[model samples]
Target chain A: MGVIFLHTLNRMRGTMLGWGLSLAGVAILFMTFFEDIATQADTLKRLMQSYPPEVLALFGAIQDLSTPQGFLGMYFFSSMPLILGIFAVLAGSGLLLQDEEEGVLDLLLAHPIDRAQLFLGRLLGMMVVTAGILAIAFAGIALSTQWAGIDTAIVELAKSFITLYVQLFFLSAFSLMLSLLMPGRSTAAMTSGLLLFVAYFINSLSSEVESLRQAARFTPMHYYQGAQAIGEPLDWGSLLGLLGLGLVFLAVAWWRWRARDIRITGEGAWSWRGLLVRSRGSSA
Target chain B: MRSIEGNAKTLDDPMQIPAIEIKGLTKSYGRVQALRGVDLEVRQVEIFGFLGPNGAGKTTAIRCMLDLIRPDGGELRVLGMDPRRQSVEVRERTGYLPGELSLYPNLTARGMLRLLNSLRRHRADPATIESLAERLALDLDTPIKNLSKGNKQKAGLLQALMHRPELLILDEPTLGLDPLMQKEVLQILREARAAGTTVFFSSHNISEVEEVADRVGIIRKGRVVEVLEPESLWDRSLRRVRVRFRKAVDPQRVAEAPGVTLLDGSDGTSVVLQVTGEMGGLIRVLAQLPVRDLETERPTLEEIFLALYRNDEED
Candidate 1:
C-alpha cells in the first residue's frame, strides 16, 4: 500500500505543483486589488443595489466590501470552489480510469498488491495532493494579507480554506464514484463537471428563486461554506456531512473496482443498452 | 480430449504439484465467449506454449489464471493454490508479461522497474535487473515513451524475469522483436526453465513455440483443440509432394496410394500429392512410375495449426 501510495504521489507531483502555483498566483493577484476595491466599496455597494438582487446573489452579495472579510468573500472565496472543483473532478476521474484505459493497470494489478490496496493508495495520494495545493494557495493569500493591509485574522482565512478543501474532497469522491459507474473517463468527467456547475448555479439561484430552494438542499454546493466561513464559526455539521458522504462514495468506488473486470483499451464503450443490461460483475 | 494425464501428479506425490491447473474454464465478454471449457495442466519446470490466433481466449485464460478476470465457470489453481481465493499469494510468486504491454511512459526504464520491484514482497535484486537489461540490450535510462517498440518489449521481458519467479506467464513473449532478439528471448526462457521456473507463454507464432516449448496447446474459437508434444506436431502434419513424370502418367495409380491424396494435376506429366502421416507408401508407389523427378515440401507450423483447427471443426 505504501509503495503504491508513494508512486501515485510521485506521478502527480507535477500536476500538484502546476495547480498549486496557478491558484496561488491567482490568490496573490486578487489580493493586490484589495486596497483599490476597498476604497470604492461605497460606490460599488450602491451600484450593486441598482442591479437585480438575483444578479447580486449569483456572485455572493457583498453586503459590506469595506471590511476585509466581505472583500475577500466577494472577490476570492466565492469562486474558489468552482475553480478548484474542476481540478478535483479531473484528478479523481482520471486517477485510476486513465491507467486502466491506457492499459497500465493490468500490469500494476499483476503485482502483489490487491485491488483494495491500490484503490486506497491512489485515493490517499490524491487527497494529500489536494490538501497540499490548498495549503500553497492559502500561503499566498496569507502573505498578501500583510502586503494589502487587510485586517482579517489568519485563522479566519485558514477556516475558509478548510471549507474549500472539504468541498473539493466531496467533488473528487463523487467524480471517482462516477468514473467507476460510467463507461469511460470522459463520460465520468463530463457528468461530474456538469453536475458541479449545475449544483453551483442551483444553489446560487435558490437564494432569490423560491422554486429552486428545496432543490438546493440536495446539491453539495448548499453545504459548502464558501465565503461565509470567513467571519463565522466553522459549520461542523456541513463539514462532517460532506466528509461522510465522500467516504461513502469512496467505498462504493472501491467495491465496484474490486468486483468488475479491468477492461483492455478500446474493448468497451458507452451504450444505453449496455448500461441497462450490464451485469454487476462485468466490465463496462 | 487430450488432457495432461501422462504428467498428472497424484495425492501420493504431493510434492510434485502441477504449476498451473485449469478445468472447464469459461469466460465471456458480452455475448462474445472468450474461453469455452479450457482444461489444461502445465507440469512444473516445463515451458508450455499456448498457441492461438487473435481473440482465441489465450489472453483470457492467462488473465483468469492470474485472477485478473474472474472466470464465468471454472476451476483455476496456480502452484497448487486456488487463484481466486489466494490471488495475492499466487501473484507474489508469479510474474506476468501482458500481451499488450503498457508502461509508465514518463518514467525511465530503471525507474519503472524500481517501482514495480518495490511492490513485490521479495524484491528483485538490482544486480539481476542490471544483468537482464544488459543481456536484452536495453538502456536503463531511456524513458519508456522514448523507447522503440522492440525496446519496450525488452523492458517488459526484463521486469518479468527480474524477480526470477517460480512461474512466468507471458503473453506474446516475443512480439515485436527482431529475429535475433527473438532467439535471445527464447534462450532466456530456456534459462528460466533450467532454473526450475515453470514458464507458460502464449503466442500466435508457431515456429517460436516449436523451437522452445516442450508441449504445445493449440486453441481456436475459445476451445483447446489439441495438446501434444512438439515432436508429434511434425508427425501429424501433412507434407506436399510434387512428382514430375518423364511422360504422361496414370493419376489413378498415385491417387490409390495409402495416406496420399492427389491435390492438383493441371498438366499431364506432373501431380501434387498431399501426404499425411507416412510418405513411404507413396514413395514406393511412385517408384513404379516412369522415371521422374520429385520434390517434397514440408508443411509450415501454420499449415499444421490450420489443419488442427479444421480437424476440430470437423469433430
Candidate 2:
C-alpha cells in the first residue's frame, strides 16, 4: 500500500504542480482585480442589475456583488467545482486505468498485495493530492483577500473551500467507480467528466426553469455550493449526501475490481464518446 | 473435481513441495475460453519451460498460479499453498515478469524498483539491485519512458530478479530484447536456476526453451498437450537428409537402407530421406550412392513444438 501510494503520487506530481499553479494563480489574479472593482462598486452593481436574471446565476445568486468575498465567490468559488471536478475525475479515472492502460497493473498485482490494497493505495494518493491542491486554492484566496484590503472572515472562506473539496471528492470517487466497471480509461473519464458538466449545467438551469428546481436535487453539483456559504451556515444534508455517495461508489468499485478479470486492452474502448471506440475481440 | 492434499512438514516426513501444481484448470472471459483443463506440475528447484504461441493461454495459466486471475474451474497450488485462498502468501515467494511488461512511466527505474521493494514482504538487497543493474547494463537513474524497448525489458527483468524469490515465473521474458540481451537474460536464468530457484517460464522461442528447460510443456489453445524431458524429445527426433547423387540412383536402394525412409521418390538424381537412427549408417549408405551434394537439416525445436500444435489442430 505504501508503495502504490508513493508510486501514484510520483506519477501525479507534475499534475499537482500544474493544477495547483493554475487554479491558485487564477484565484490570486481575480483577487487582485477586486480592489479595483471595489472602488467602482456602484457602477458595477448597476451593471450587474441591468443584466438578465440568468446571468446573475453566474455569480451564484450573490446579492452583494460590491464586496470582496462576493466578488471572489462569484469568480473563483462558483467555477471551483467545474475545474476541480474534471481534475478529480481524471485523477480517479487514472487511479486504475492509467496503470491498466500502460500494462503496469500486472506488475503491481504480482506483488503480495491484495486487489483491495491496489485500489485503496492509489485512492489514498489521489485523495492526498486533492487535499493539497484544494489547500493551495484556499490559501491563495485567504491571503489574496488580505492583500486586497478585504475584511471578509478567513474561516468563512475556508468553509466554502471545504464544500468545494467535498464536491470534487464526490466526482473523483464516482469516476474511480466508473473506471473499475467501465471497459476503458477514456470511457470512465469521459463519462464522469460529462456528468460533471451536465450536472453543473442543470444546477444553473434549475435557477431559471422552476421545473428543474426539484430535479436538480439529483445532480452532484446540487450539493457542492451552499450558495457559496458566504454568510449562511453549511448545508449538512448536502454534505452528508455527497460524502455518503462517494463512499458507496468507492465500495462498489473495490468489490467489482476484486471480483473481475482485468483485461489490459480492448472490450471497453467504445465509450459513448472517447478514444479507441472498438467492439469486443479487438485485443488481438 | 480435484482437491488439494495437506502437506506435513516434519524431519521424518521429508515433504516435497512442488513449486506449482494445477489440475483440470479452466478459465474463460465472457464467451472466449482462454484456458481449458490445464493440468501441470512444476517441481521445486526445477526449470520448467512452457511453450506456446501468442494467445494460446500461456499467460492465463501462469496468472492462475499467481491468483492474478481466478480460474473458472479446477484446483491450483503454488509452493504447497492454495493460490486462490492464499494468493498473497503464494505471491510473496514468487517473482513474475509478465509477457506485456510495463513500468511507471513517470518514475525512474531506480524509483520504480524502490516502490516495488517497499511494497514487498521481503526487501530486495541494495547490493543485489546494483549488481543486477550492472549485469543487465540498465541505467537505474533514467526514466522508464525514455528508455528503449530492450532497455525497458531489462529494467523489468531487473525488478523481477532483484528480489531473488524462490520461484521465478517469466512470460516471454526476452520478448523485446535483442539477441545479445536475450542471451544475457538466458544466462541470468541459468544462474538463477543454479542458485536453486524454481523457474517456470513460458516462451515461443523454442531454442531458448530447449537450451534452458529441464523439461518442456507444450500448451496449445489453453490445453497442456505434452510435457516431456528435452533429451527424450531429441531421441525420437528425425532429421531431413537430402542426398544429390552424381548418377541416377535407385530410389528402392535408398528406401531399403536401415534407419532411412524415403520422404519422396528420388527428385531426379537427389533422394530426400528422413533419417531416424544414427547418421553414420545413413551417411555410409549415401556414400555408396555417388553422392554429389549432401545436406542434413535437423528438425528445429520450433518445428517440433508447432508439430504438436498442428497435430491438435488436425484432430
- Output the number of the lDDT-best candidate: 1
List the candidate 1 regions with Cα displacement exceeding 4 Å: A266-270, A273-284, B1-15, B239-260, B268-306
Backbone clash pairs for candidate 2 read none
In order of appearance, the predictions have TM-scores of 0.90, 0.89
Instruction: List per-prediction Cα lDDT, in the order shown.
Output: 0.86, 0.79
Question: Which lDDT tens digits does candidate 1 get at residues B61-150?
Answer: 998888888889988899999988888988888889999899999999999998989988547878788888888899999999999999
lDDT of 2 at B276: 68
Give the candidate number with the greatest DockQ: 1
What fraction of the correct interface contacts does each predicted structure contain?
0.78, 0.82
Candidate 2 deviant stretches above 4 angstroms: A55-59, A265-284, B1-15, B236-284, B290-306, B309-311
lDDT of 1: 0.86
lDDT of 2 by residue, A180-202 (tens): 78877788899988888888877
Error of 2 at B184 (Å): 3.5
Angstrom error at residue B73, model 2:
0.7
Q: Top model by TM-score, which number? A: 1
